[model samples]
Target: MKGLFKSKPRTPVDMVRQTRDLLIYADRSPDSRESKREEKMAELCKNIRELKSILYGNSESEPVSEACAQLTQEFFRENTLRLLITCLPKLNLEARKDATQVVANLQRQQVHSRLIASDYLEANLDLMDILIAGYENTDMALHYGAMLRECIRHQTVARHVLESEHMKKFYDYIQLPNFDIAADAAATFKELLTRHKSTVAEFLSKNYDWFFAEYNSKLLESTNYITRRQAIKV
Candidate 1:
């Protein structure tokens, strides 16, 4: 019947849930060449684009809807972050960028009364380390780097990143042989040091002995122009 074929409108929650399911399947069987799988991925991409539009808004002077933001925040509170992280390294370039953009946009929203907060980010502190590890994969580094920068926007996340022993790994990441990955690592380094001024200052003062000594030799005086530039900016 025509009635049976009519399209049902999807709410924001429905779209997010669908995205999460697709990400899980994509991550588990990324190399599958089946037509159904490919079609599902294309549909997933379309859903993400639509979700981006809803959270942002159209071209008119119409005020952005607070309802969309609230719905998105609720979605973040679910297991969606796990799906996003697991799927980031599996997606193609375009979908990966869109996925990272979704996380970045969510970081800019607030759920509990305030207009800007980090409830979603603060809950997932371990993601920073996982993202840092993403630098090991050349194909996924840029997308993960973009997501890392957004995570570091939260003071709590920034502090965790600075204090974790993982901070020592940047010395090698910024010097990676691949230009793009190294450049992205350098940008992530700069964001970590500069985003929360007071936190970084405290971290530096506390770890003054070895931190600067390594920084001076590897980053500041390095032959790579981008490394030196990023050091100066940091």
Candidate 2:
């Protein structure tokens, strides 16, 4: 038959083209095809993970370095915003924790390179909505506090947090009647202000009157604690 001699089934490139067309069709279909969309998103996430592995892997050869950089740029170009939103709801607590660690590692490794992923994640409105959806949970708050510290390191991130509705939850967590949470929040706040003195001082100058009374009261209380300890020692 003629089919039996058909150039070894049109070669590998033909197969790849067919597969790509199928994916394109599925991705553009209606919401009724949600399962297909989810599968596509999962595949995207897998590719991102592989790219991250290459970027942060143990190999230090120039080829590996170049490949890593290329992969990161490609991944960022393709899925920077989508990855942040998709990963938020699907990530388990461990994955969430790892995500924070990855952001920290990226900051340390790149220094002046600009945080493409974190900047995209922080700015994506969909991701912000998801982030704030769990704002009231204690565990989420803890993770958020850590992320906020990292965000405060960058001016753009600091501005995003300051303008977000999420700021209310953070302020509430710090002012809670629970002494333990409040204490933890105070420690975190002190660290944030120490690290980001100029930006935070500017923020305080504009907004201090809104919170100055409570902050001053807390400062006085802390002073009183130190004074009482000294008196007891005397």
Candidate 3:
């Protein structure tokens, strides 16, 4: 009788939908009263923490596979990932950490033995553009850079970025005065070149002269000690 009266447990899909709704709400400009805005942000953070717990099990228990599948399926179904990424900057530091973890974990999550995150990313490739551009935003670079690194884990995603115009910017990004962002950018640049040897070889073969010209002039010949040290990795 007590069990019958209890509220039905929220399904993983329900949780994702709830999170999406909050994200949509937060995505708008702040016209609401300050307290209400704070309340909404608090709710959003709680929801993200719950999402993290679902993807990565909490201390109390390991994650259940079925729930994870449902959550992951619902996650990439629409523009949810895009919403999360664009709205990430508005979130508090703790919320940003939770969302970043959720994103990084999702990139590895398999749905029906398939990496659906990769497929979603393939269709919404522009999200990679936004993330790559994060290297230029001081406040967002690390968060966006972290997510971007996880995203390029897919060879298709890696190839898209390797071939995109963003490749040209990594020269300056790897030399930013902020060592952490520079290092992160360097890691991502190295991964883009080294991850899929075949794709990288083909890209380099075609753009070899131009790419190395910039590499030598921009990185190898840079004034910064850190930049010169990173240039040696190439």
lDDT of each: 0.79, 0.48, 0.92
**lDDT accuracy of residue 107 in candidate 1:** 74
Question: Ranking under TM-score, best-scoring first?
Answer: 3, 1, 2
TM-score of each: 0.87, 0.54, 0.96
lDDT tens digits, residue span 87-176, model 3: 998999999999999999999999999999999999999999899999999988999999998998898999899889999999989989
Q: List the residue pairs that clash in candidate 3.
A: none
Model 3 alpha-carbon drift over 4 Å, by segment? 1-5
Off by over 4 Å in 2: 1-52, 58-64, 78-82, 107-134, 163-168, 175-188, 216-234
- Among these predicted structures, which one has the highest TM-score? 3
Task: List pairs with backbone clashes in candidate 2.
Answer: none
Top of the candidates by lDDT: 3
Choose 2 or 3, whichever is better by TM-score. 3
CA deviation > 4 Å runs, candidate 1:
1-5, 29-33, 58-63, 115-117
| Candidate 2 lDDT tens digits, 43-81 | 544433443454466455322544544434443444433
Query: Compared to the true structure, candidate 1 yields what TM-score?
Result: 0.87
Distance from true position, residue 50, model 1, in Å?
A: 1.6
User: What ordering of candidates by lDDT runs from best to worst?
Assistant: 3, 1, 2
lDDT of 1 by residue, 1-234 (tens): 889998989777788888888877877775777898888788777877766677666586442566676557656757787677877665667777777877777777765555343666677777787888989988888888888888888899999999998888988898898988988888888888888899999999999999999999999999988778767876
Which 10-residue window of candidate 3 scores lowest in summed lDDT? Answer: 28-37
Q: What is the lDDT of residue 103 in candidate 3?
A: 97
